[model samples]
Target: MTLALKYAARSDRGLHRSNNEDSVYAGPHLLAIADGMGGHAAGEVASKVVIAALAPLDEDVPGDDLLGKLHEAVVSGNDTIAELVDQDPDLEGMGTTLTAILFGGGRLGLVNIGDSRTYLLRDGQFNQITRDDSFVQSLLDEGRITPEEALTHPQRSLVLRALVGHEVIEPTLQVRETRAGDRYLLCSDGLSDVVGFEKLAETMQIADRQACADKMIELALQGGGPDNVTVIVADVVEEEPQPQATQAFESSNNHMHPVGPTTSPPRPPVQMPPQQPPPHQATMQQPPQQPQKKKKRGRKIAIIVAVSVIFLALIGAGIRYLAYTNYYVGVSDGGEIAIFQGVRGTVLGVGLHRKVEGSCAPAAGPDCRPLRIEDLGATNTTRANEGFPVNDLEAARRTINTWRSEDQQPEPQQPVNCPTPLPGSSATSTPTDVPSLPGETPPGSSTQPSC
Candidate 1:
């Protein structure tokens, strides 16, 4: 019961865009699509970085470790994107949607994040295999919007989760059994956004895999391919007698490796040659060098080390002084309310951090505006960053509450009681205005407090 994957992939820049921002990788066992998102071509860079991360996993892998390897690759991709953003100050806010599938024997492993999609057509039934992490999807799940409404929703493409160079990558991972007739498709919003599910099913029903992909891109263009389109169409087929097989796809700009008909053979991993250490390790491992040279080198090293240590110490002390004296609250690179040693956002691509223990959310009030007007579950990170720095969650809450309270106008206060006279009798009283409370002052009262 051996299984092999036959996949065809295609990417197009579409009518509106001059350059194709979408990237696709198709191999014997792995198929992936990444939709870039950002201005100034940063999105293209992000998508290609992700594809490159997944390029090494094209061969068959262990069924048990497939999910783990996929996770590691995607995590590495996110970290690489973070490092890229760190290197380039202008590439901030770049992100990409990744949807990938790993075929390990008869089981299909899917790792997805953001709004790209993976779909399955089996036994004449059609199903969307991956859930889109989008604002409108949340609305649809809450029964707030209908399927038709989701298509035209203003914020439909506003992805809720994505690999945006964050410290964490939360792609959904799943393993599912496959049958001979099962057909799978991985695509970006460029195709799924335009072609309806029924249209997709009808297009997939086409006999030729390349034609299926080409038709999908065609329909997407007909529906106004406002974004870059990328598609991967793969089918599960029974093992044949042919020991090796390779196919070229006319619709694909990328070439997929020859998926063979023979059972996957276990290949030994490439090993590096054993070698002696170059400098530091060799010095530490070897016994004391010649005593005379050692003493002379050690003395020179000691002086140099001492001077370097002194300089570093002075710089560290200055940094500590500034940290404690001029600390403030701001959102970290990971979008958490954090205390920083310097300014809120990074300056010149260099970041500052002092771990704070809390997450801030919008204060639910009748008068409070919704943080994400179109995105239902999105928290107002800006409002969260407005809070002052505090030690714990409780204090963070208090700080944010205090900030909000200060923002509101003070309520009118009641008039203070003086020694007033009754109907028939008069009581003596000081002819001066009185204060009610620290934060309160009565209307029409002229009371000025010490500055």
Candidate 2:
């Protein structure tokens, strides 16, 4: 069944704001809102210009393609703003907060920058769809301020990124599926500042699209809308009901023992760690050694060798687990970024199963060792990329091949082992102090020759 959208949009010049620096576009399947930002009148001009520039995109396209088009539109709008500012010095620093939604093909494409926001309401729940790019938002993300404090922050309107003073501006884009009975709201900070989520949800639940937009703007005015206000409402309509499992939400599937009907309890929710670890003391005492020092030396060496082999084997197993789980490299314009274990933007990409083993075996060279594979049960795993589903081993292999096609750098057929440092040299097994990703630590591996 085809999914459709019913939407309405409105904008207002708030009580304190002299002019309407906000704009809205509402089509059958397209909805957009922009809140202009500049001390002078140029802000209104910049936002209107962007709205005009993006007025032509088709809303029925795939989410990724819609995102690409929105990105291009933002770039073009940035160029337009830069040219205008160059021509008129008074227009310098003019920018805008943009939040847009294109709903069609049973999906919704979301784009935003600055402080404008998008939200989704479904199943008696509401979720924010856009992350604000503002000083207060960043502070909230870092736990430096509470949500209440952010509402009255001295520099709450200050934006970290916007479409201004440049030839190109990249927007954050997301692709999400939409279903019947789902609702979306797009609004400027002016509305969000005055009308909280609970109130917004209540308004949406009780009113039609036009009434919802009007009521939100009215509430913002009551709270002394110091800035321009804009709001949009979109309702998803599908002819046939679809299963909820295929939506973008994280899965909460319970695990059952392979042999038993259900032996394990449901997994607990993921929780962030505390700031520090609790202290504990060991109670067991070691037995006293009684022997000639020479007699124990050989036994110690044998045990050390066995432990070393076991550690290497564990590392290999971990790598194999990542490989079969559809791990892939996500290359942003910033540089080559890796997405591993469902976390995005790791700096160094680890090739767990490179084909170096096929052409250059370990006998030919140490670097040619075959990649390892491991299968951890489904309960403890997630896909490799941000918003990506986990794939099988065959899919991961194909993805690796695709990455290798663009990576033309020559590889040493044999692994080049780093030589052991001579006596008196500062030596350590850990790699250099490298920075970690959004939610990861630098991998702990030996700098010593693995070959």
Candidate 3:
């Protein structure tokens, strides 16, 4: 399908400006807005040059080809403006903000610089497409001011970047898919800085392209219109068939610009002819048909299979976790007391108060201690009132020490039944003496027990 647009554009001097320095050109596939700056009519000349440079690319540009050609147009406009200023010193430092859009191939390619803006209205919502290259925006970026503060900043009109003099002006370009019923508005700062997005959206919602363009200009004029105001509104529409060659018909004189009442600036209009009689007309009719069943069914099955695989993987993971944490308790012997086999920890709140007995330290090695009581492998205790069972053995020891310090308690006076070689503990022991053959003195010891 060949995509097209119905567009209307206008530029007004406004109440405050001396002569209109803003210029706009828009068509089904071509839309450009430029706001000029400088003294003595130099701004006017620079803007006109930009509009002239971009008017030709509107004919037919593929989506891929749009960015490069649009960039070239900006540079070309800059160079032309620079040459004009060189011929006359009065045109020095003359510059303008240029924003243009080409809509075709079911996409919109945008190129812009300075403070002018382009907005996309889609599904009853409008969004700004370009950022302003101005001092106020710079202040906002630096975090020195809020967006509301910057909006009313006195230096808001001072542009930081623009197409000026002999400098090369390559604009930033953005491309996005265009949809049916989409509407676009391109305008100078005169309209944007004064009129908020909500008000613009309201006007766009109720007005057609021509009415929307006029209303934007009207609002700016009402708001003191401190600068030249310009607006171009374009709406995505289906292209209609063009009729055979016919004579041009002009609109009424009252509708024409006062300066060129007879000259008649061209109207970009497309005329459609009656349904044709040709052998290839069926090919052009766009075949009507019933929907394909196979494609829709295939899509549905793919979604179901993907969802099922994810569900099964989650179920398998849960089963593996339950088998690992359930095992044995404690046991006993003569002098030595063994605790439960495997990692264990004392649960608080056992005796008079709910406080576990034991200080904890992070475990270091086989002899040092394990990080967790579980790392102890297994434990058994001969006496029930021994030290606490801690899943983190070292942590348990530290905790015991902390409690002892806080309570200022002395070591136990009674001989507690601790293991000769403590369970799950590694401590070096002294060598014991043995009698040699009933009569000889021990090899390393001189003293003997009195008879």
Candidate 4:
């Protein structure tokens, strides 16, 4: 089946921002969002430049070339930033996060840099497709912090990577197969940071694309919009959307900076003439139908209840899969090296992970070493405390083995000098006691001296 996108785009300056630094674009074949960072109007310029660089890809592209095109466009945008910075040194520190998707040959080419996000909703399931390039995200991956802690982290807004007028940085790129009913949402951190994931999923379920985008913007503003918010909501459909009135609806009274072709405003309700009863029924009185109506209502309630239960079950299963499939190396309660299955954090006070192997445990095999956390040295000890995430049990074992090899190596000894005896002095004369080198202990002391 031929697939096409029906999309809406919206942006607001938000309550706290003096000017909007976010830019967005939505078209039949592409959707993109950029969140700029810098003081003054430089942020606005950064976002606009990046968005403009990507706007050209909103046309037909071959499936195989989608990723290449996206990468080239992102590099071009980075180059433009460099040129701008050269022209005006004040814009040197300015940069922007980019999250975009290009549709071609019934597939999607996705690229992301910094913290902006892209989410996909299909078959009643919602998931984030792009991982954030941010400090908090790395902490979460290493199990040093939980998702909740990341939200309020002092450096929550610190983006680790972006297109900042310097050397070209590679962006996260992927190609995804699309389905007719799939829906995608691309937005900056302003909306994502404020609105929780559950609320976003609920709003995205709205059938009308425009309505969904509008509700998302409203939710961000309601949540005390601390940054500029931008949103683009698009749905994949088998049939191409027909052209409609070109009127644009403002996202907010404060400011309306929508990019690309905005979806038409909600159409006025059509008035219909009242109809009289049919000729046969006009002469006859209709019987009361409250019982049938009640039966239909009860059936509807039952269906709703069943669907909710199924959805919850699916969500639970997905969570369980995510929790148990991964493994990590960490310090156990006994202060020894250990292997854990599942995530490091807990949910509602229940631990999400379990210690699967302790130092030299029976299941750890003959090569396992009875090593304590302290034996790993200071650097590795810190890593053990944070938990070293691995893809599977084999990888965890490999990590332990590598650490063991490093620990087994002998430390290099420091050289020391001994004074030569005088030619006429007795051969057995005791060496004169001299002050030791700085930071060193004297001879015969518990600590060795540097001569």
Residue by residue across 114-166, what tens digits does model 1's lDDT show?
A: 99999999999989989999999999999999999888888999998988896
Go through the candidates in order and give each one's C-alpha lDDT.
Answer: 0.65, 0.59, 0.58, 0.74
Candidate 2: segments with Cα more than 4 A from true spot: 59-64, 239-451
In the range 1-451, model 2's lDDT, one tens digit per residue, is 6676666656677777545667666654457787887743456666766765555443123355767777787787777678766765556678887898766556767889899999888998988979999999999999999998988889998899899857466789988887889888888898898887778878878556667767887889888877777777777776442211000000011111011111112222122112221211001112224222322332343234324423443454454555555534333232222233333333124333322112122343665322211121122113212323336434544544433443334566777866688898755565678777876756775445664
lDDT of 4 by residue, 1-451 (tens): 4676778778888888766777766655668888988755566667766766665565233457999999998998888778877866656688999999988747889999999999999999999999999999999999999888887888889999999979889999999999989999999999989998889999988998877888998999999989888888888888534322111122222565544444433332231112332211111112443224422332343334324423443454456668999899999988989999999997645567998987565766786558788788777788889999999887887888778777655668767765676888753535459788998766655444534
Which one is best on lDDT?
4
Local lDDT at 29 for model 3: 54
Candidate 4 overall Cα lDDT vs. reference? 0.74
The residue-level lDDT of candidate 1 at 321 comes to: 45
* Clashing residue pairs in candidate 1 (N, C-alpha, C atoms within 3 angstroms): none
- Candidate 2 overall lDDT versus native: 0.59
- Please provide TM-scores, in order, for all candidate models, with all chains considered together: 0.55, 0.52, 0.54, 0.56
User: Distance (Å) between predicted and true CA of 165, model 1?
Assistant: 1.1
TM-score attained by model 1: 0.55
